[model samples]
Target chain A: MKLTTLAKTVAAAAIAMPLMTAAASAYELVIPTLDYRTGAYAPNGIPFANGFTDYLTLLNNRDGGINGVMIKHVACETAYNTKQGVECYENTKNTEPSGALVYQPLSTGITYQLIPKSAVDKIPVFSMGYGRTSAANGTVFPWIFNFPATYWDQATVFVQYIGDKEGGMDKLKGKKIALVYHNSAYGKEPIRTLQKMSAKYGFSLLLLPVDHPGQEQKATWLQIRRERPDWTLMWGWGVMNQVAIKEAASIRYPMDHFIGVWWSGSENDVEPAGMAANGYLSGAFHAPGDKFPLHDEIKKYVYDKNQGTGERERIGEVLYNRGLVAAVWTVEAIRKAMEIHGTKEVRGEQVRDGFEALDVSEARLKELGLPGFTYAVKITCANHQGPGKVALQQWNAKAKQWKIVTKFYEPLSDITGPLIAEDSAQYAKENGITPRSCN
Target chain B: MSPDFLFFLEIIVSGLMAGVMYSLVALGFVLIFKASGIFNFAQGVLCLFAALALYDFIAPGGWVDRWFGFTLPVWLGIIMTAGVMVIVAWLIERLVLRYLVNQAPIILFMATIGLAYVLEGMGDILFGSDVKPLDIGLPQGASDYMLDTFGLYVEKLEIVAAFVAAALVAVLAVFFQKTRIGRALRAVADDHQAALSVGISLRTIWVIVWSVAGIVAMVAGIMWGSKSGVQFSLSLIALKALPVLILGGFTSVPGAIIGGLIIGVGEKLAEIYVGPLFGGAIENWFAYMLALAFLLVRPQGLFGEKIIERV
Candidate 1:
């Protein structure tokens, strides 16, 4: 019995040893990726996860980690579920020594859940372009960062583009615009902003909500046929995007007049509808396709070395590039963090400081091999969201590529700014958070 | 006709067409349940897998093209996918159903749920988790002829799907009525012990029944994958079949068709006419509510055979 107990003790130690080793590896900067590679959203999630992981792998393979510090990428699958996302955060947050530097869940639902938790844990939740639009108010949401743009910002950009097409903002008057969206928190995000915009611009706003998975949209499309809205904007993800596009095409809804948010603009969404999806416009922050200098570098460092995460051909697809951009921001923030503290080993709290002070200028973007990709971003304590600029991209089915049809333009901040302040103030009051003074 | 009347007619026509698509999936469920008394929960996953296989076989730069150096024509790829589904059916009968033979019906149902997860995983592993556009040369977009002549819009693909579903039902009806194998399957379903006494092989019948069900899944997959790209969510389409089964009865083939039509029209009308009163998106739960009402009135379903169990 004593021998058996000794043997059991030895086995327990063997299992615990590796975990202890992992915890002790504090010298290596740990970045936890909450990824989804299965379930309904897997088609969209896989490419983004691949791009994110591949970029981090590129940093390790090409540059020997971020500033000679070996990066430990710990990936946890959330399956695009909010519950699973919270579970992943709870499980991976405290990895011993120095906890995870940052978390980019790439999901709006997950981002919403983590807003409060990040403040307590001192772990920065970088939602990038998706999350609570009110979280863009940095004073209220100190740990939550949705840089470059928010959903509200994107909504304004889409409306601005529509106005430009009709000659000017004044032309939007009396025009009926329908918002066909997924009936979820993520889908309902742009409604308040669009409503405010409609009230200001005199365009009648039509709300059409399609439930989750969004396969059966026959009823929704038939209504669109009856109503005959002038413009239709979709805020959808995964199969919802594809089905909506197909339904829109079947109704002979002029594809040019229909626009989707960035989440709906992936190749997966348009490819299903074939030539019918041609001329479908969508709001975008970055250029599409794998033609950038960063692509060449990724091919050399990641693909050639067989350390790639996804198919070689699908390197610069929209979602993949979104992931690459996410990884680029993360690494750039870590660099800033290191420079600020003058230390290689930085904790999650220090990373939050890094996020606030981040400034990716145009020259800096050129230096990073991604010139003219996206607008230059500068994150401050007062504004977690950077310049909320967006561009319009059109799908060319024959060429099978997305082309940026317009120059990068700014969102209507006059309306969005006040809306953000009002929404964030309400959120702060409800959550019992004393708004921090950025000054 | 008045414009409003024309629009109402358009809604009904569209609903019937959409109903045909739902019936196509519900048909697969009736086949498995009627033959084996097992609710095949993996039917939707089977559809997803079959579609993924068809895409991999036919698509340029697909698995067949990458590995074998040849791309299959659409028709040939479908035939090959049918063959693959038959093999999967045989494997399921041999490995899963055969072992659980004579077990409780719930046991068989649970096995299918397991089969679903396994098949979903296998599909992702084999085909990769990328959504692929499937084009089997079926007509898509608005039917210009109908739109111009009737002043009503109808999708060409949905029309094609309606025809395909009708043809499939006719073929299935004939197979069940005329074939000797069909008689054996019915006999096995009625009394397993009695069928065994009559020299019928339960295993063989199960394999054949599953194979037929699988082919039906392939058809449903093709139609749906053509509408929306074949992806992981294709499996979730099974949820749409539940209300159909409840209203139509789980064991009746014709019942699936009628149930699909009622649910389709009822939900569409509710969503369009009544949904706005309650803020829209009521179609998602409208069918389930109708199914619940049906259960209180007629539990055995509209076409289901009422079993008289003697005490």
Candidate 2:
């Protein structure tokens, strides 16, 4: 009996030995990026994916890995379509190297569809600029995180910027402001926020919708010509931005009075208009141009070695920087996760904890060479967007660059907090989501 | 009540102008269909290409930036654009449409779809994917001088577009009725085999018809592109013309104009007065629904020849 028991113990030890060794050896964190490398939006998508991949590569090459855990990233191209993005999410959800913490869909449409699924799968979705703005309320949407800013935050800042430009908030009392937007959920996101503000500010709001892909806007512009609105807020994407700018210019509308969201502002948006795009302003979450140290490092480490993803000149443009910033936030979240879990090897849940605990301070931003880029943001039990601020940048004709004019912060707690809560409750009721109690 | 009445009138007039724009695109499709019995799916892309070419020529500090030193004047750029369209027409006929002339209508239609991609790629390569302001030197600020008491304010661009379209239609009517080439075109369109037997070269007629279509597309491009800027998405306006073609006959110019007007005005009025009750954005689908309803009632469209198959 003793001899038989000894033999069984030996067999068990042989089976368990390799796994323990494997666990102690170098571990890997597999991150799956759902990228759109081709399609109607490839102009924006390709560069963003390139930046994302390059940043991951940068972490591997420069710092060896995130907290010594090498990241194994696999990119599945979705081509900016929602169905393909979901398919990619499903295919890469449980990929080897175990912890697939975050998924950035890069499309609001896809983000909306994935929100419920992500929550069920226990994987967090990071929809930075575009998504259901109410998803910013983390209490109901525990798995969805739209850090830095929400559409409502952007709308509030846009109004605040207009108020600032007019010298005071009182100047907005009787002005006619037009919201020329693409007729999609992403386009209509700021409507409720803008309408609410307009009601309070006593400004007239004209809602104008340009259909998807926004090529033909003669009727919309004709309305603009008819109404003669004092200011126009553009919520557009891809070719839509250029069309709006051109139409506004053709009508001889003051370009300075026209404002676009961050997605609406890019080198592609103005390159077509050239001189005609002068004085057009857009609210930006990050500054344009690649003057940041991280950019310089990318140039030195990546581009210099011909390891860059895009053309050398396009390395630090607005969209490219935004992509890099998105990567930074992601990696920082991972770092935070490692800090809390007391080990480099963490699961998707631990990564979520990290995101919730992120405290990106001004000092840390400056250290990262993203000075004046963003304020200190902290995600909490109820707030997923964190402290949001936007800067207004105008296209200068002489300098041929976007110059930051001023920064505006919305009254988040007073305005957005209640709205988010109410919206989350409504959304929870509709989606049959049970809100988590913080206590 | 007066404000609502005024708003209604404004919507109707504006919608009519939009209809004219749609008619211009529908006219290109009609021209191609009349000559070749194949719908030119690339007509919208052709419009976009022409407009982008014109804008690029005039925009300062571009590919030809050093040639003119600064910006080329509007008239010169427009003339150059016309020359470019003629070349594009020749190339398209020689390289694509000519080869598929004897193929099925579906095959020919698919060829135009291929041509659309080629043109889009070439356009993006040549002009880049940026939106450029199309400054065609049309009069501006006319909308401000409103006949307020009559509840009417006319935009100068709209006035210009109406006149240009009317003039083009008149010119085309005269060309088709008065010119010998026009007679040959009509003959070829009527009976291809008979026209070929009569010693009229189908190739020459095809080239001429496509050239004319190209010119019309350029004019339409300028009007629409100037209003909305020349971009890739500008080609989607062609979809708007599909319902116009269904409403009108595929071979009738007057049908195109009238059909465009009906669809445009109908959708606008429905949206303004009836839309809010149902939901806004009804205008987006109303045009197609109206056309579909019309097709159910009149399969040959308002002017299309009724096909009577005898098995």
Candidate 3:
């Protein structure tokens, strides 16, 4: 019995040895991803997690990590619950040598919760396209970074596309536009901006709030059928997207008139409705498909070596591409941090500074093997809303692909800028935060 | 008739049809409660599990072909799922229900909640968390002919679901009236002591009732799963079904069906016609508010029996 116990103790020690040594190493950047691989959102969550993880794997294997120091990626499953997300942040924020780098809370609700906490902890947050739109005002929210584009930016893009389709921006008058939004912080984020645009453009804005985990929208569709809104925009997620598309198709609503946010444009959302969802349009930040040069490297080093994160074929779906873009930005920030700090290794605080000073131009993107994927973003000391540009993707049933039909549109800064300043100021006042001056 | 009036009538028609879907789920709750006096909170998860099981057996890149060596047709897949549910019912009766016999109703209800978590976890584990297309060749889309002839917009899937729910309720009613085991179940539900006095085994009745509930759940899962994919949100239909159960009264089978329709129509009507006055999406709370208002007048529910205690 004593010999058997001794053997078990030795085996346990051996199992824990690599983890202990990895934590103590200064030659690695720790990125603990807060992932939701289970629960209601997992259908959408799995592909995103796979894309995010696989990109880092590609860099680690092909390029010998970021500047020779490897990445230590840890994933904790939050199941899309806000409480669990906070717990995951608490559990994995501290790396032994480098401390924590940055956090990307995939859920907007989770991002809101982590905002105050992240500030207190002095860790930068990256809410990539789907968090507090007012966090675009980096002067008020220095710690919160909603770079690439915010929901308000995307909402403005949708209105722009509508305006373009209607002949011109001046023709938006007397148009009946409706907003069918999820009833949460994530869904409600774009309401104020849309309301402002409605007043400016002389369009009627009908706001419909679908409760969380929205499945039953029969009555909502009936009202739409009766009211006959000329155009509708949906801020939906998971099963909500599929149901809305099908219900809209059932009522014979023109698919071209109904648009969903970027989060609502995944394959899982459209394929279930089959051919009926043919012309449905959605907001997109990054181009979808695996024809980029980075794909070749990823295929050779990660997937070929059997180190891929998810199903091999699903690497180029909408959400997966978004996840890959998020990681690309994350790595670029890390590289910028290394340069700014003039060190081979950097800490989270230095990384935050690097993020503020970072710039990913078209030339940098081409060098990184992602050409024409998305617009270049440059973060400034006072401006964190990097390249607030968005494009529209249309689902083609016959081709079975998401084809981008519009070039990226810049948000109407004349409207969205003041709204961001106002909301972020309110948040700062309520939370006792002193707004900082970049000068 | 005016187009406005026709539109109102069309919304009402769809509301009633959607209510039938809710009633189909409430039908499962009524069966177990009538026979065994347990709420069976796991009814929603059971619905998802059944659909997941059926879809996995037939869907390409699903649980069956990935884990097992064989594939089956859609009909055989459904039969295989039925067999799985029977085994699930057997395991529940033997392990959980059998031990908790004669416990307080609240305790039994809590145990079912525990069962819900277990089933949800097992479903996620056995079938991966990704949503699978659950097309068993069911007809989808609305009939253009119906709309053209009568200016009515009726969904073909909803109409099919309505007929299936009616057939289920009718068959269950006949079985309860004509079968000896059904009579034994009624006796047990009436009084456990009296059931024991008459040589009816309470354990056997409980097992039979649970198995019937499982089958009802499977049918409900198929319809809802067919509407959406076989995803985690399929389990949330339980919340929608609860208002139906409360309105229908827990013990009456036909009452459950009618109650489901009433709540469904009430909520839909409120959302479309009345929702404009109040911003919209009132379907979420309208049913609960309606049930709450109805309960104030009829505490025993629309068809539940009056309770009298002698001091």
* Predictions in order: lDDT: 0.92, 0.81, 0.88
Interface RMSD of 2: 4.1
Every model: Cα RMSD to truth: 4.7, 7.8, 3.6
lDDT accuracy of residue B203 in candidate 1: 92
Candidate 2: which pairs clash? none
- lDDT per residue as tens, model 3, B1-311: 89988988888898898999999899999999888889999999999999999988888877677778666899899889888888899999998999998899999999999999999999988888877778988888777888779878888888999999989988898889889988888888889998999899888888788888898999999998888788998888999998887788988888888998999889988887788798777887889998888789887789876667889
Sort the candidates on lDDT, descending order: 1, 3, 2
Ranking of candidates on DockQ, top first: 1, 3, 2
Candidate 1 deviant stretches above 4 angstroms: A1-26
A143-249 in candidate 3: lDDT tens per residue? 87888998999989999999999998899999998888888889888888899999999889988888768777887777778778999999999889988888899
Output the lDDT of residue A212, model 2.
75
TM-score of chain A of 2: 0.92
> lDDT at B238 for candidate 1?
94
| lDDT tens digits, residue span B125-231, model 1 | 99988888988888898899998898888889889988888899899888888999988888887889999999999999999999999999999999999889889
Q: What is the TM-score of chain A alone in each candidate?
A: 0.94, 0.92, 0.94
- Using lDDT as the measure, which candidate wins? 1
Q: Count the backbone clashes (under 3 Å) in each candidate.
A: 0, 0, 0
Name the regions of candidate 3 deviating beyond 4 angstroms.
A1-27, B64-71, B309-311
lDDT of 2 by residue, B140-176 (tens): 4336556444646455677788888888889888888
User: Which candidate, 1 or 2, has the higher lDDT?
Assistant: 1
Q: What's the C-alpha lDDT at position A396 in model 2?
A: 76
